[model samples]
Target chain A: MTGHPHDHGHAHAPAAAEDGPPSEYARLGRAVREILVEKGILSAADVRRAIEAMDARGPHLGARMVARAWHDLAYKARLLADGTAAAAELGIEMGPTILKVVENTAAVHNLIVCTLCSCYPRMVLGIPPDWYKSRPYRSRAVHEPRSVLAEFGTVIPDDVEVRVHDSTADLRYLVLPRRPAGTEGWSEAALASLVTRDSMIGVSLARSAHEPVETA
Target chain B: MSDTPLRRHHDMGGLPAGRVERADHVLAAWEKEVDALLVLLSRQGIIRVDELRRGIEALPPDAYDRLGYYERWIHSITAALVEKGVLTQAEVADRVATIAAREEAER
Candidate 1:
């Protein structure tokens, strides 16, 4: 077997678990991780490299794709037709799940939520937002998506149909948010700046061309 | 009236709930490690992501509600490792106690 896939320097120091300083889950996690390491099930570098790779994936990747869709109609069709291949075309590995890109149109607004235990397109978005994983969001996103969207300052008019996609472990969704008006002729890079993580998740709309970019 | 469809606590969807609080924070280092370990172990074919999900899903509602996202993952990951015979529960327990003692002595 490989070096205890878990053995090597723990990336962090020990603490308490459950209630005190550290969490019980935390201690158990560490203990379990160390034992595996000692067994050569996992190495320290394996753990570290895994984490580094995850950290490398960010919502920006999704933003870039959304921006590309806005820049090229053919790419948009491809994204909608086959998200996995399109992502591969862009050199983005989508991990194990199949990505489904839902486009937001003038009359149809799409929202993405994993009602079950926070399934998300983590391959590109890295970790999901805390709110996205909360019981409130998970429970309410499908039943009251408009309200949830309103909570995020995104109001959907009565005329527009709001569609919420419930993601599973094997299938994930990404929102191809409608490009803001007046962004015509904008370069793909510039357009990408307006595609906020929330926009890609359908919590918010893409920023207006005149608006300053979101820091996140 | 139609009978209410029963669902697991974690299977909540379209269920009446409170308002969503929109907030976010960076993942702590340990949480990231838990995530990484799960990924690495899955890559090594020692465990499957769905197995981790099952472990999380099987959590009693109280414990499920109590643990954070990564906390839940680590709990499930640890349990799965023990079940797979890849790591013994005794060793894990002893290591946890050892860690608890070290943390206590440091304080």
Candidate 2:
């Protein structure tokens, strides 16, 4: 509910016309935003703050939740039973949308997708990676999940079932990836470090304790 | 396409497509702005999230296919604003023209 100081500076304006005229969609978007700000329906500051809030969210939060669940069987049960409340217990507000935590286990692998659109668990994991929204991903994830996972270098054994969760409703899905072996005594912080965004999204596995950590 | 049971643009799950390439492109500046605008509009109750989704789904198939992730959001937000009578198409066009002219002058 805070207002941002209105700066007339065009610092954040779209790039110069050389990139070809801003697409019609972009032009109209800018126009609508300007009109809203001009009429006092919304302020530049309000928008900036909202953007900042979104920017602050990232996979670290989700990784922490995963690590905590990995260490505490009771907490893992709670997380699986009610993702929304469990996330709130860890100081993450999931907003109005319902978040469902799906676990990856020995016999099954889980993958998340929004067949209808780019519905994501942004509250915990921030904005989705670009590939998650691509037509290839949206289509392929559910159609041929194992192949899609392989593209991300995640190969599932033939004995394991691949479960694809299509986020077609209000429920957003986050994968509670199987905790990698060889880290039985690792601290929660160390364990969380092994959780990458792609792993939470179920496209890749969490890094092992001995493996180097990768960032998105 | 005709054989597929799910023809809706948003119902893209379980269809055949290309390989999943892993490339990380920094979000464009304008895209960040648009994302903020959409979040603000929804937060203020000026538009509902469901309405925004419908707006995106309402885009023509070709346009929907052509637009990038944030570009689709831009189109949806603009359409929602116009549809809600928060802004008229003419006013938007006029404002866009003015902004375009201003950018021209700056260059």
Could you say which candidate leads in lDDT? 1
Give all candidates' CA lDDT scores.
Answer: 0.84, 0.83
Task: Please tell me the TM-score of chain B in candidate 2 relative to the true structure's chain B.
Answer: 0.88
- Candidate 1 structure quality by residue, lDDT tens digits, A167-203: 8658788999999999989999999999888998999
lDDT of predicted model 1? 0.84
* Candidate 1: segments with Cα more than 4 A from true spot: A1-20, A214-216, B1-6
Interface RMSD of 2: 2.7
Tell me the lDDT of model 1 at B5: 77
Look at candidate 2 and tell me the lDDT of residue A36: 88
TM-score of each: 0.91, 0.90
Maximum-DockQ candidate: 2
Task: Output the worst ten-in-a-row residue range by lDDT, candidate 1 chain A.
Answer: A11-20
